[model samples]
Target: MTPRDLLRSAGRNTFRRPLRAFLTIVAIAIGAFTFTVTSGLGTGINTYIDSQTRAVGASRTVQVTGTSVMSFLNERMEVYRDDMDTARGMDVGSGILGEEDLQRITSALGPDDEYSANRQVSALYYSHDGGQRYRFVYNGYWPGKTANLVAGDQLRDDTDQAQLIVPSYATRPLGFASAQDAVGRTVEIGVLGQDGEVRTVPGTVVGVQEKSLIGGNLPFGNQVLDDALQDASWAGSAEDDAQWYSSVLVTGEDPDRISRDVAAQGYATATAEQTVGDYKSIVNGILLLLNLLAGVAIVAAMFGIVNTLMMSIQERTRQIGMFRALGMGRRRVFSSVALEAALLGVIGSVVAVALGVLAGRLLGPMALDLAGLDLPGLELFAFDATSLVAIVLGVTVAALVAALPPALRAARMDPMDALRENR
Candidate 1:
């Protein structure tokens, strides 16, 4: 038979038993659907990290932190893990960050590198225009810091006016009409000092920032504002020693080299890229595990396809003998069965890809909204055309592989034996 005629015959034979064909296809689709969704999740997250926040790691900045050596965290777990790595064996106080250690951290950097200590601020409650108090989360600004702003500018190191940048979500809750309106508003922060009294610090909102898939939604503040908050954090405490800083930010032309140099000084350092890489690794690992599960399902479905084909061959033994008697080649018989299996793969995978893309578009935004935060530019399940195409091809090849045993059995049958099998 011609290839076209063979294909047409295979297509018809594939659905001769509709229920069996459908069951086999459904099994394949179960696996393909899982793979499609997981693959899209990985693609979406990696894309966001690369496009929107790659600067976080690529900007040549290293975050340096001193390890904590003591903690009695039988109750206060959050306290022990807020800023430092509290996982260490018993030591006589591993001591606070001494001036000598601080000096080493700064001197280890190249001449062109800039250093800025982080002022750790504890929990804060802020109010606007005498309104109700709301929880405040913020990070101090450094020279390498960036903000994707909807209005105004990023925190300037040159400014001493205690600048603040709020995310768009904070605009309405903080009593502002719009993102532009949120700018230039005074925000009053009420913090509980170490001495057990409330200290209020004020900062001016100079910018409104955009929300990102990877970037933290915490507000950004200049050093001036951080200094004020730090003062509030330490109010009424003894002035017997200089303030201890657990972490610092270092910016330079080469952060990896600086990280190594600083590590030599008994301090741990992570470049922004390394931090992002760690996060990416976790995401990829989880997706890989999910993909493996899907692969197992696909394998199970392959077996199902094989069973379905074997049954079809059993029912058509005399038909095969007739085809061979009519001068059909063994290769064409094998191709016919294999093509039937490929047809199953095509139908199953196409259905999976269609549903996966639909779920990504329809459900992705609804999920984002249900999260109770506005993630304007996030694509939770971004489907790539290349990935979809690859999935279809992989499944088709897998189906063909599954057909091998059945196709071989049919092709190797002697014409007389096949014809007499009915008797």
Candidate 2:
């Protein structure tokens, strides 16, 4: 028989036992469905992580902090009590970067390198239209980091006045209809003094950003605002001794090399890509376990394929003999059985992918809601085309391989002996 005829016969033979074929297809579909959903979950989480990492300037920059002499001791108790007492009275910025350390980091940069200092803001308070007020922790840094802007413009370095960038999540809570409405509005931030006093500082709303995965509840400000808040917070305290920075942000053409150099200078360095890589590794590890569980289901389905094809071969012994008697080659007979198995696999995989995608779309938001996470622009389940293709091809190949033994047995049947068997 021609190849086309053989394929047509194989396709028809797949459903010869309708009930058995249906059960086998369902088994395979179970595996495909699990794999697709789990893979999509991993992809969604990693995509969110990558976006947040980029937003925090992790990719092209490294955070540098001064190394402490406490590292020389094996245990915290090993430090002298006198030293602990001294540390209690020291400023919050003690052991962090100072003017000399900042200069050293700046001098180590290449001609194209840029650096900025981050300072801790004591507290941030916001009120609107004489409504109830709210307070939270805030951080100050240079503007120019790419962010998911919802309205207005990013804080510019040239801006001399204090400005604030609110997160979209705070829009309604802060009494704004939308992010656009929040822009250009004046807001009061209560900067806490070292003596536990709340001092109000005026700041103009320049922009609003979507809530970030990594940044959490901490709001951001420009250097101008940060410096102003720092000065105000230090008022009535010892502000003239020496200024210390929380951390130094360094960006260059070669972030990895810069990180290493910064580490060599007795500073702890954290690169954005490193943090993202660690998160990716964790996500991949979890997905691997999930995929393996799905693989177990698929493997069970493969055994079903083997059993179904073997039974079919036994029942069709006479038919095989008749086909051989008609001068069909052994290889063609083998191809026909293998093709039948592949057809079943294709049907199962197609239906499974459709159902899986539908389920993912439906369940993604529900899962997020159940978990109590209100992340904006994050879909808990997202399909990747490459992953879908791989899953289909892999399952089909597995089914074909499972049919090999049955195909071989049919191919080796003698024409005269098989024709004599009872039908």
Candidate 3:
């Protein structure tokens, strides 16, 4: 028989026992839906993390921070921890980086390399619109990468006036109705100065960003703001300047070699890849477990496909014998059975992927609301063309594999015996 004729026959046979085929398809769809959603979540998170990492640091960035008090190597460098986040940044066990310390840290680097300092700073209180002042924290690490702007513009390098980017979640708490409202507002920042007192400094809110894991509740400051805060910080004080320094950042193509060289100079280093990967690993671990559970569903669906096709073959014994008697080749018979199973899989996967994407668009925001999170631009169900196509192809291939036994049985039928069996 021709391929088109065989395909038509398979399509026609797939629904001979409509209810059975329907049930099998349902089972496959369930698994496909779960797989689509889980994979999408992982993809979305990884994409976001990668973009953020690029903005915060380069592939070859090596962070040169203060000495690690936790290190038993006689305080060589700041201890690196995967779990360390912005919330626990200041409390991390590390000695101060002195001015000489910055020089010492950079001196170990190749002359072609340059560095940026992430001096730590705090804002005791912020006030706008004459409301109650709320406390906040600011960091000096500047990616000048893509800014997650909901409103206004990213901090301009051309200007040095203290400019801050507030997170979207903090708009209401900071006396703003919306992200747009928060922009361009002059606010008071209380920075602790060298003389041991909090000084109210004026700054403009240039932009607002999405709430992020890496940054936590922290707002970002431009270079001028960072320097001003650093001037008030412990490491920035002239009296302690010679004895302490903050985190210094620089880029080198070969981080392993760069880190090794720095270690010889009595310093420790953290690459941007390592720091970002730790966070990605945490995300990946959870997604892996979720995907595994989805895999279980798919495996169960395979059994459903086998059972459905076997029953179909048994019901069609006489029909199979008649087709064999009609001079149909064994390969054609096998192809027909296989195509029926593949049709079921194609329908299931297509339906599942379509519904999954729809659910993501409709219910994604509801999930965030239910969880009491205000993370803007966070999509729980992101999908791409490649992955969607892969899901369909994978399910179809799995269906064919599962139906192999039934197809072989149908192909090997003895015309006279099968014709007489169901008589």
Candidate 4:
């Protein structure tokens, strides 16, 4: 038979067994719908984690901390192509990175690589002015240190003058509306220098800054927590010698590997990849459980399809015998059955896609409400081309899987036998 004729026959056969066709199609639709929704949610979660990690500057940072000597070369470098025998451990505390180490690491990195080094001293600050003391955590810096900035400029390179730049919103308490307002103003900071001296540095507000979503926050400082003391220019400097920093920031391809190598050099590295992975793992684990439950609902639906198809076969036995008696091939009969199943799959998938998109739009706002923060620029669901392809493939596979047994059973029927059964 011609392909068009086969399709026409399939359509007629489907309607002739209305209850069976309805049940099978509904099963396919349920499976397709569940798959689309779950997959979309998975992609959304991954995107959300990426955004948060990137927001905090996770990928480009490899947080370096004191490690046991044995931590060095803990595992063999089997994955690396480089010769490790000639590589020596670089000690961070020894100040080997002052200038030369920076050049070497930068040179060793591919042409695309760029890096910045900083002695990150975590400290607390509060508005010294009696106006309203706000406590905040900030990354202390030496004058002119390069921390990636999002809004304002970095501290000047040539001066010993201390300077500070904060997020755009940081200026609200400083009697300013934004980073532009805080710029050029003086801000008081409580910090400890390398000499273990506690002192407050009344630094000029140089610039505001933003970092990339794939990189992280500024290297020198971040938005202070609510409890960190907020100090204004009127507040006199206070010093504490307890805080110390042992970290450097780098960005490029294989940032995580570079961080591992930096740890080999003895300086602590902080990269965003580790942070993003941790975030993804946590979210994926939770979502995976939810998806599993959704899968159960779909599996139940597939069994319903099986029952519907079985009934369809029995009802069409006489028709099958007539076709076979007329010299129609068993394979031709099988094709008709399979095509019907596939068409149902396609219809279900199309409907599910539409429904999933609608659901995602509605659900995203609710999810954000639960998160308790407004994500102004963030989309509720982040599905890309890959996700779209996956949905189509998944639906098609489900249809074929459901069709196989039924199609085979129909094809195996004998003309006389099927006719007798119809009686």
Q: State each model's CA lDDT, in order.
A: 0.78, 0.77, 0.74, 0.57
**Candidate 2 residue 339 C-alpha distance from true site, Å:** 1.5
lDDT of 2 by residue, 187-263 (tens): 77787765667787777888888876765345577777777787667665553545556678887878898988877
What lDDT tens digits, residue by residue, belong to model 3 across residues 20-112? Answer: 889999999999998888878888778777766654545676776555432446443355444333222253444445466677777878877
lDDT of 1 by residue, 241-318 (tens): 355664677988888899899989977677767767766898899999999998999999999999999999988888
The TM-score leader among the candidates is: 2
* Local distance difference test, candidate 3: 0.74
Q: Give all candidate RMSDs, comma-separated.
A: 5.2, 4.3, 5.5, 8.6
Clashes of each: 1, 1, 6, 46
Candidate 3 local lDDT, residue 373 = 64
Across 245-333, the per-residue lDDT of candidate 4 in tens digits comes to 23345556677677767666655454555656756677788777766765675566556655666678877887887888888999998
Off by over 4 Å in 1: 49-58, 68-96, 119-124, 129-135, 190-200, 211-214, 228-243, 264-266, 370-373
Better of 2 and 3 by lDDT: 2
lDDT-best of 3 and 4: 3
List pairs with backbone clashes in candidate 3.
68-77, 68-78, 97-244, 97-245, 98-244, 98-245
TM-scores for all candidates: the values are: 0.81, 0.83, 0.79, 0.70
